[model samples]
Target: MSHPHGDSKRTVWYRTQFSSWMIAVGVVLAIALVVIAAINASYRTVSLVLLIAAAAFLVTGGIKVTVSAHGVTVASALVPFLRRTIPLDRIAHASARWTRPREIGGWGYRWKPGLSAVSLRQGDALWLELVRGTNFVITVDDAQTAADLVNRYLPGPGEGR
Candidate 1:
């Protein structure tokens, strides 16, 4: 949704991504472990481990990135409790760029000294340069539009983008 109110434009944009391959692999491994457990009770412990792995995959399978009046929020599409929000006022600049998982650390949620990213794939991403000089990135489709919405919320002139 997009609308202009007074001097500022209001926009609420969101994108979601699901790693089906990860889920599929997790399920297959879990089933294999279940079969092994059925064959030998001693393998029940191993089966439990596989089950946990499957649960992890399911939990991290999907993510939704939202740009709203409040700020930018990244949450698990399946479990919203697993989320992070970056306040709009803290953002100095926003831009769209292509990035790979390795460039900002592996997929899913990642945090390093001056960088944090919720990179799901190697493609378009919205990059945010925070006021503190740290950077945040999230891989999503239509990143240009998302970045544009974020830029609107940034502080007035001289902030530089």
Candidate 2:
């Protein structure tokens, strides 16, 4: 749904699909365990483990993405503690980039090895370079859409592509 205000400002929302994969794998394993349990009477322990694991996957796979007139928010099932918000005024520049998995290396949020290393995913990213020598970079799945949002709300100098 579109925001209530007529403002043209945009917000790009993003979240990783890894949790989905985990959930899928869990479901499959659970099914396999159930089948094996039916055939082997001694595999009750294995079946129980698989069932628990499957539940975990299903819970963690539910990631959510939401965008509003003000900013973007991403929520994940696997990482229940993760909550990130990028305000319009805090953003300096926004773009999308592709990087190798190993290059990104670390899990969850990551940055490249150089001074200007951006997010590793191919999603949208906003560069928030504050005045206090603090820079914050965030990535979202929809790059162009997110960029458009930033353009509408906070137009930087010469920022149209």
Candidate 3:
């Protein structure tokens, strides 16, 4: 986590690891497809699809969660609409401790029954209790620090002043 010099408010960046793996795997697959296409012309169609998929991953893969004094925001590197911003006031509680992807019906963006999650990898995450609809959860590299940072902005007991 690196902090900017001029920014007075606290800000933390949560880097994603799953997207890196996806892009790497996609590139290798695309290269193999091109090789196959050269050997046999019929494989060109498959190669095109592989290339498109690789490009999609490049555009919509990496995720970065930023926590500042104002709020917590989850943003996609390439797409602006993919960003989700939750003000610090909306955060009821920020806790660490996560479940496996399998428990939440695989990673990425998933919803099951009444629960929804945005997770890239299976590990510790910042489980957020929101004041609105449902809770929001996101997997992060450092959950303890994130939770502590979030908790710091939350209002204390019996003190709305």
Candidate 4:
């Protein structure tokens, strides 16, 4: 879809094997909790908690990254309440790079000192260097296309538009 600001929205979803494993584990744990609760009524509360955790795991099973004039937004598909959007104007540069989870401290969402990343797996990622010095990275396929779109949205040297 196109944004009112004259920019088209581009979105990509990345689902890792780890996420599938996590969802499976969560489902199994929730089922086990239910069985335990059936044996003893006192475990019902714990079972409810497990169910919630499982739902969270399912909801956040994949990462959705969008690039538009509004900026680059990284968020969970089912849960959009918690998201990070870096305005195009604030980005100094954007590029596609190969990165690893260890470099960013581990998977999921990570933040360490000058770098923040949604490090889903060890592969191509969109690297954004913001104007303030910190960098944001997102592990997604076709990182080059996303980087190019972000660069296109960025204002040029003397063109205020």
Summarize candidate 2's per-residue lDDT along 51-73 as a digit string, tens digits.
97776555545544444556655
Over 4 Å off in model 2, which ranges?
1-6, 10-19, 25-62, 77-82, 106-141, 155-161
Give the per-residue lDDT of model 1 (tens digit) for 66-87: 8987889989888899899999
Between prediction 1 and prediction 2, the one with superior TM-score is: 1
The estimated TM-scores of all candidates read 0.82, 0.47, 0.69, 0.74
Off by over 4 Å in 4: 1-18, 37-56
- Winning candidate number (TM-score): 1
Quantify all predictions' global Cα lDDT against the true fold. Answer: 0.83, 0.52, 0.72, 0.76
**What is the per-residue lDDT of model 4 for residues 42-153, given as tens digits with 9 covering 90 to 100?**
9888887778777756555567788876888888765777678988778988999899889877877778999998876789889999998999998888788788778887
Model 3 TM-score? 0.69
| Residue 83's lDDT in candidate 1 | 90
Report the CA-based lDDT of candidate 1 relative to the real structure: 0.83
- Winning model by lDDT: 1
Local lDDT at 106 for model 4? 83
Candidate numbers sorted by TM-score from highest down: 1, 4, 3, 2
